[model samples]
Target: MSLLTTLNDDIKTAMKAKDKETLSVLRMLKTAIQNEQIKAGRDLNGEEELTVLSREMKQRRDSLAEFEKAGRDDLADKAKIEITIVEKYMPEQLSEEEIRQIVQAAIDQTGASSAKEFGKVMGAVMPKVKGKAVGNQVNAIVKELLQEN
Candidate 1:
């Protein structure tokens, strides 16, 4: 099913169950997806939908980090819950080892042997891993691998 359709169904379920936390997150996600559609002047395809979902998850993760760093346990706890809720809609994440392997392959494919070719390696890798991995983690692996080359 389309992400929007799935979100709508989940929203209804959350409402029926009086799941405020889940409902809130679902509403926010629905709104984000809708906004992107409006901006594009059309319905988003699966890849576009995944892009929006990834952005939302990244924002929540960044918020979680900041909250914890600031020692705001209550807010951090909420952010953590929000992250978990958002995660339910994401693709299964790639493990570090899987990501490393992908990055290594990209480097070989692109003939990228130094940090100077970061963009080249990343261009080759991102499309392969897309929603399955976080950019920062992929980036770090690429850098580590390239440095070793």
Candidate 2:
């Protein structure tokens, strides 16, 4: 099933089971997806859906960090649970080793030999790693590898 279809089914299930936390999260997810569709003036492809889901998860993580920083453990805990719920729809994350390998391949492919070519290497790598690895982590690995080369 498509992620949107799955989310819709889960929303109904949540409503039936009276899972308030999950229901709220699912509703918010549905809203986000719908908003993206409206903004684009078309339905999203699977990749676009993943992008929307990733953005939602990132927002939750930022909220979690800010909540913790303000010593609001109650809100932080809620954000953590919401993140867990959002993560259910994401593809399997790439491991550090896998990400590093991809970065190395991109560097070789682009002939990027220094930090100055970071943008070139990143352009080559980001498409392969998108929605699979953290952007900053992949950038760091690329910088480290380029500097060593």
TM-score of each: 0.97, 0.93
lDDT of 1: 0.94
For model 1, the stretches where C-alpha displacement exceeds 4 angstroms are none
lDDT of 1 by residue, 3-89 (tens): 999999999999999999999999999999999999999999999999999999999999989999999999999999999999899
Task: Report the number of clashing residue pairs per model.
Answer: 0, 0
**So what's the TM-score on candidate 2?**
0.93
lDDT of 2 by residue, 53-149 (tens): 8888888888998999999999999999998898888889999999989999998898888899999999999889878877878888998999999
Clashing pairs in 1: none
lDDT of 1 at 107: 87
